[model samples]
Target chain A: MINRKSAAALIIGDEILSGKTLDTNTQTLAKHLVRMGVTLQKTETIRDSVDIISEAVKRLSESHDMVFTSGGIGPTLDDLTYEGVAKAFGLNLLKHEATIARMHEIQPNLVLNEARLRMATLPEKCDAIWTGGLWVPLVCVHNVYVLPGIPRLFSSMIESIPSDHFGDVPPRERKILWCDLAEGDLAATLDKAAKEYDVAIGSYPATNNDSKKLYRTMVTVEGDEADIVIAAAEQLKGALNARYGTV
Target chain B: MINRKSAAALIIGDEILSGKTLDTNTQTLAKHLVRMGVTLQKTETIRDSVDIISEAVKRLSESHDMVFTSGGIGPTLDDLTYEGVAKAFGLNLLKHEATIARMHEIQPNLVLNEARLRMATLPEKCDAIWTGGLWVPLVCVHNVYVLPGIPRLFSSMIESIPSDHFGDVPPRERKILWCDLAEGDLAATLDKAAKEYDVAIGSYPATNNDSKKLYRTMVTVEGDEADIVIAAAEQLKGALNARYGTV
Candidate 1:
């Protein structure tokens, strides 16, 4: 049977919305989720607001099997991931002694002031997935995994997660074919093939930035059945070539 | 008065969600919106599914002053933006002669097959915003603006958008200060300053990939009142310097 697990990403940070920082976490998470046979269905980027965070988490969690949240987990005033997630689940925010211990281990000489200690507070009934030494563990509350927004930290934490966390299934097979013709000219064939085949097909009309080719159409087919997906791709290529000549 | 006409982006594409393509449209739009004094409140990346597209467009259109959508407007089987937005507004899809004429102008030598004609279909009761010749005009349905997914095309379309569309206000003033100290150590002070001043402050802890400094904290203050925003920045800087010498 095909794996049906679906995931969504909630990327929270004022910096991203202000265009001060570029978000790579969504793309990173999507790649990993796909590797685990889970489809990343949607991603939302919002500011560091508690109300927005809580509402998005609640809604996404109800619809998806897993929801990953990146950012607002730091020890700054704007970091409200713990509080917002707790409010969403109706849980109290409590200090995690283990997290505090890990923090001390990371920076033994640093003072554990109120601000530094803030990172220790997490939603009640949450579990921490410790990746390795000196790094903060990823927090898991219900179906949502709270991750740091820092690209390096987020990537490392995700790397440490067991590949089995998202379950397993037959890997999806995809094949892409390129045609020089306008995608509009091939839309009817694509529409017909999509209905007849069991594969999901996508047609992209792209303009090369530096290449001599002004326009190229990319047709992609993805499905669990490799043979069927490949067949669909080949059929699409044939139709495009038949009408507009191959690129 | 401050311009509070905020907007949100709906980036629709399977390539983005499947980790096949990186989405830069969100950042591009955010920067442009900020320059025009329109805050980009949120952005969502969803699949090419008609149901998902319609729901997101309808919901965001109701909440935001303006909603911009990129992708899924092409002439492919998966290109459901026209159909989706129409469904959301309870409008019928109709063939527009102007759009058809423009398509022909863009490719005068090509035959207008059923697939090619698909590009002429659009939602009724909508107005077109033509940027220039030979390009498909951006469609405006209610508060939503549908645009192409191609980066070059999207950038050009956005740039061609009337500057007066978002309304004008006193340009926001921003000041960023970098500190070598851990952001956690300065959270409390940052929080206090944000409440005391009529400015928004954000603390970002970043790790330098190629610099000697392992970590640097970025403190940003932004507001319509230039004096208040700058004062907040200076105050925060003084507090940080008092605690840890400036970098």
Candidate 2:
């Protein structure tokens, strides 16, 4: 049996809950993690409260193999991720000389004000994961990886993550079938097909917009057995095609 | 002092976690709920597992004044929201005759297969919030309101929800100050200003894109006291300008 790794994301932001900003970090992390064979179990978006962030971090870290947190790591008043992580692990916050040195190296003319220097302070005993090219590094405190919420920065930092972060399990293979029939029309056929395979089947019916396909279904087959996953995809295709015309 | 109402949203779907679908329902509900004096406290996205869904619903409902759930309430095998909601409330699942009648009324020639008819299976005791003309209605089980995931249907259903659903708290007044200062530069100013006012002040710094603004910070002052919210916005604007030389 393949040992599957599980992960969860903690998106810390008041902007997200207030509808002032749309959070794409969760989706980005999910896609990246899924492609790496890590099952993203749950994602929670909470307000930027230090106590709540600390509690959630500790809880998620205990339950999941790996916990990725986005947002709240910025150099601002609302950026309390470091403090939260410190509280969760009962570690003291310390200013790292390396981070400060790197910051100066990257932004030579930038003022090193109290606010800017705040980024150097992080949870004690945490390793900085940097790609050498980027000045900012993602902080890893135990099983929790603290990443900035900015989409570009988050993606860049994630790319620097080591290959072993996802563990030894193979990535999932997905097959999608776009059907002309509405989800209601294809319900029975999908039900039968889903029961036949041990794969994860998802049905997403799009709202009537100007989109070409009325509905789309994705079949994810991931496990140690590659042949079974491929075979299931073939069977699903045949079944769906037979019932409703494929788009 | 104003009594603040709180809400949380549960987005249930495997597709969302798989990165196949982007959930806008959370934001849609957040924007609408905020206008009604309801502060959306948190939002969670979990796979379509009955146990997980039920647990999340129960937990969220207890913590929040109102809970809105989106997705997994469709007519498919994976559509397990009704079951989850029922389990959360410890209520028996019954085929709601009203829902069945509405389903048939909407899709007259549609064949009501067992899978399709599954949409009609709701919790034993619940109120259906419906618009006069729309056949599909949002299900309300205790403090949890079940709305479908589809954007169009979810929005339409939410519109039918009674105004009293968000409680009698007076709507908050909001004032925003857009500044060109980076979040790091204005952290101390924002922190000091936030403590001085009763309003909820949030500083959101946007990532630099191709847009004209290199950096954008949104200072949001929201509270029942219009005078305080407005004064804080003015104070924040002055502080930011003095500190960063506003763009």
Candidate 3:
């Protein structure tokens, strides 16, 4: 199966930076990308200023194969993601006829006012992917996927993306071992296993839900090969003397 | 009262980027910073690589008056934040006697293993804020505050910091106006108030919690001064002709 291997997320909003809003888009995008075997390397949350947005989009787009931006794609004055993206590519913001046509197709009685028409103005060099019968198409400019800030819409747009649109990936696997010892106590054991197995292992101090389950540290072993990942997890489980293999 | 005017958060972790953990420290920092009239300009969540951590910390520190980092400050092999910070300033990682002493003070019979002792090794030049009767000091190197990844510990460490520790403040006030109209419909009104009143205004589409309250769009008005924020909210409240001021 074709999949994107490396990705980055850029969350654009003043509300998020201002603490007026909590961004769930990063996690949503993360879960979806992980399922596609895409490793989300970094996420940058910045204000809605066009200057800030353009600079960040340019920087992130250059580093990762696929870049996903959430928020500030609406019709408001604060919605400057389209302009920022256009600026990032040194393009012009032009009214998109397809988006306008799709808007009418979705809502026959829609009043195409100045504000509503503002949504049609997008980067000159972008393609719009209309999916799931939604009027607002997923705007693609280069490697960046410009999505709306709304949780429901953003998630649906991501879900509708075809896998081939990405790059490539090997089927990855994850295994978690629950250990009662403190993270420090399991550190040396984790280090030895990680060095020997040559797999991605992470030790996390448990909290909230994990704590409720009487779990202390959750050691995760992951790799592109299932056999290797499993072998590493087993080694760590035995080395740490962990009883519960809770992957 | 002194308060830092601008802040940035650097979240260092593999679990967060790998979608294994959701980061709540940014919001916790934002809320606290906003209360002190400090604008959290940006938040960057990256992997637990030393190079990535060092580069991000250095860049963010230069941009903001205060920088806070969450995660990657443990005893495991993956814990590389301290090394990253020291590398950022070209400083050496040295053992701190004060941290070791405090650890003994907290737990007299504790074993200072190589793993646990790793926590005591901080940057060469930094102040250790011993607070909340906790052995682990809040390591402050330059403008960056290196904090633990655990949500509870991170929150308590932040709470323990005195207000005077910051630069300056003028008591921020926030007011939200809940309207039963779409965000697009309220766009013009929000824009006008923002331009006219010279206050920070944000328009958010109602989420799960706000939707349960029968609210559609939440327009927030905030400023360092209370009177201007209220006046702007009042103007927007009247201009939008919304009867419900939810804040």
> What tens digits encode model 3's per-residue C-alpha lDDT throughout B55-83?
99999999888899999888998999999
**lDDT value, candidate 2, whole model:** 0.80
TM-score of chain B of 3: 0.92
Give the docking tier of candidate 2.
Answer: medium
lDDT of 3 by residue, A1-247 (tens): 2345678999999888766677888888887887788889999999889999999999889988889999998777888899999999999989999989888889888778777888999999788877777998799999999998888898889988888765446546888888888988888888888888868889888886453376788888888778888888877777875754643
- Provide fnat values for all models in the order shown: 0.73, 0.72, 0.66
* Per-residue lDDT over A122-234 for candidate 1, one digit per residue giving the tens place of the 0 to 100 score: 99889899977645768898889999988888888887777667875755887877677668777788889989999898877765452435446777778988889878877
Encode model 2's per-residue lDDT on B1-247: one tens digit a residue.
7787789999999888877777788888877887788898889999898999999999999999899999998888788999999999899988889978987787688688777778888899899987666666688999999998988888878877878877867678888777777777788888787799887877776665424354477667778899998788888877675223221
Ranking by DockQ: 3, 2, 1
For each candidate in the order shown, give its overall lDDT on alpha carbons. Answer: 0.82, 0.80, 0.84
Highest TM-score: which candidate?
A: 3
Query: Candidate 1 or 3, higher lDDT?
Result: 3
The best candidate in terms of lDDT = 3
Interface RMSD for candidate number 1? Answer: 3.1
